[model samples]
Target: MVKKNDQLIVTIEDIGANGEGIGKYQGYTLFIKNTAVGDKVLVKVMKAGKSYGYARLMEIIEPSAFRVSPICPIAGKCGGCQIMHLDYEKQLEYKEDKVRNCLTKIGGFDKITMEPIVGMDYPYYYRNKSQFPVGKNKEGKVVIGFYASRTHSIIDTDHCYIGADVNIKIIKFMRSFTEKYNIEPYDEVKHTGLLRHILTRMGYKTGEVMVCLVINGKDIPHKNKLVEGLRKIPGMKSICLNINTSNTNVILGEKVIKVWGETYIEDYIGKVKYRISPLSFFQVNPIQTEKLYNLALEYADLQGDEVVWDLYCGIGTISLFLAEKAKKVYGVEIIPQAIEDAKVNARINGIDNAEFYVGAAEEILPKKHKEENISADVIVVDPPRKGCDQKLLDTIISIAPKKVVYVSCDPATLARDLKYLHEGGYELKKVRPVDQFGHSVHVETVVLMCASSEAGKC
Candidate 1:
């Protein structure tokens, strides 16, 4: 019987959904982290379950062909990037397979066509946004880095390989500034201290950067000194302070005060300009985002005279993209700030045919469809990781749009939502997985579905 602390050799047969390597020994399933498929490893079982167990990889006896030395020394310790041990090419393949498996196993559809995963040429250092948690390590010193795995403990990294180059400099500057000013890092357990997190946002194309500091209090002592230090860096657009006094896992607070520069920074994605604020849901990878949006536009197949609806529209990024080709586009988001940004973004791009609304997409769509008899030729949905609510899926079916373009971040939820849509009369067509987050387990996918009839009817 497999017991805790048992050291045994195991051969990794496959990669699990969470990027952990799965192996079996004497019919006991073991999940080992920092491992790769086709590798044989000596693992020490950490915990034993009834049918499965978790392990810590002690040594890789035989490395997989896809295995490559990770770029970051603490890559395995940090939760930011998974599958970093796997080669980039194999990573792409794994992501594609993940999407395919989700659709097949969850959606229960195997006849769908899958396009080659759109990957980044230069995958590393592509992240435009980064949020570094500030906490004290075991030595009781101020540490700034990502949370280690499932724990809130800091890994104390000087640099993150996947984050923007400017992030390292910003973190270093903050570390110095905090230490000099005698600012204490927040202790979640005791619910004491001030500085909690350091968030950095960069505009890849425009070369703009925004640094926002999260604090337990409303103000920071020696704020001017910190602002002046941050302004020394070129392209620093905005510096803001977000106050989160609550003792919770949430990073940002309800109140945000600008310390220096503008409250928001500007960035362009394929001719469409967007003003990204601290809370805006902008895509982290701009280069890959353009490709992902372009692929979505392609799948949308706008013919210059279509009425488009973009649900869960974040600052009208996709709505504006589709507006140029469609006759008119209507965008709906639950967040008022996002809706306001959407309207401003539309005006910035000189797009007059796009309209914005603030309400729950599921509720608003059904209400609009009933009261105004609204109809759409193409409906584009980019819901949260939880995917579309069942009511939203039912609403989409009832509205009966000619085409549905789904932009999904989570494959399992995407497949489930696709299943609901497919059962509602839309035929599953083409699926393209875009690697927006390289070196990470996350994969963004765009799917195209068309109604069986020209005038969609349930």
Candidate 2:
């Protein structure tokens, strides 16, 4: 019988959704992290359950052909990126399999077409945003870095390879400024101190940067010195302060005060200008986002004179993109701030066709469709990680748009929602996975579906 502390040899047969390697040991399933598929490893059972167990990879007897050396030394320790050890090509393949497996097993789809995953030419340093937690380590020294895997404990680091190179300089400057000025790092336990996190956003196209310091209070001592140091770095457009006095895990507060520079930074995504504030919900990867949105646009197949509805539209990013092709586009979002931003974005871009509405997609879209007697030729939904609400799916089915474009962040939830839509007489047409979060287990997918009556497949 398998017991804790038992050392066993296992051949990893598959990779789990969380990027852990799945292998069997004497009829017991073991999940060992940091091990790739087709890898033979010696594992020590950490927790042995009846049918499944967790293990620690003690030794890799044979590495998988797709295994590659990890670029980040602290990749395993940091919760940021998993599967960095896997080759980039293989990572794309694994993501494709992940989507397929979810659709087939969870959605109960018999046959579906999955296009090749859209990957970055240079996957590293693609993230436009980085949020490093600031806290004191065991030695009582202020440190700033990402939290360890599944823990709030901060790991001291000088740089994050996946983030913008400028983040390293920003973090270093903040650490030095805090040390020199004797600024206190926020203690999550006691809920004291000043600095909590350093949030930085870089514009890939415009080369503009926004640095916002999340603090326990409104003011920081020696603020001028901090701003002066940060301004030394090129492309420093905005330096703001966010006040968060709560004891919660939420990073940003409701109050945002400009400390030094402009209130917002500008970025362009394919001729579409976006004015991003500190709390705007913009895509972290602008390069991959363009590709993803382009694919979504293609799936939408808008040919002017079509009325398109973009649900869960954050800041009207996708809605604006669709507005250029469709005669009229209506965007619905739950957050009032995001809706305001969407309206501002539409106005700035001179897109009179797109209209912004503030409400839940399920409630607003259904109600609007019923009251206005509106018909959406194409409906594009980019829901959050929880996927679309069931009522939203019901509404979409009831509307019976000619085309449905679903942009999903979580494959499992996407599959579940897709199953509901499929059962509602919608047939899955095409799906293309986009590697927006490179080196991480998370993948973004764009799926195209149409009603069976429209496709003549029913």
Per-residue lDDT, model 1, residue 418, is 97
lDDT by residue (1-458, candidate 2, tens digit) is 99999999999999999999999987899999999989999999999988999999999999999899999999988999988999999899899999999999999988988999999889899888999899998999998999999999999998888898889888888889999999999999999999999999998889899999999997988878888999999999999999999999999998889988787888877889988988899999999999999999999887798999999999999999989999999999998989998998998999999998998888888788889987788999999999998999999998899889999999999999999999998999999999998889999999999998887531
Off by over 4 Å in 2: 456-458
Clash counts per candidate, in order, are: 0, 0
- Quote the positional error of residue 236 for candidate 1 in Å: 0.6
Q: Which ten residues in a row have the lowest lDDT in candidate 1?
A: 449-458
TM-score of every candidate relative to the true structure: 0.98, 0.98
Q: Judge candidate 1 at residue 36 and give its lDDT.
A: 94
Cα error, candidate 1, residue 208 (Å): 0.7
lDDT of 1 by residue, 1-458 (tens): 99999999999998888899999999999999989999999999999999999999999999999899998999899888888999999999999999999999999997978999999999899999999999887887889999988989898877988889998889999989887888999999999999999999999999999999999998999978988899999899999999899989999987889999998999999999999999899999999999999999998888899889999998999999899899989999999999999999998889999999999888887788789987788899999999998988998898888899999999999999999998999888889999999888999999998887852431
The lDDT, on a scale of 0 to 1, for candidate 1 is 0.92
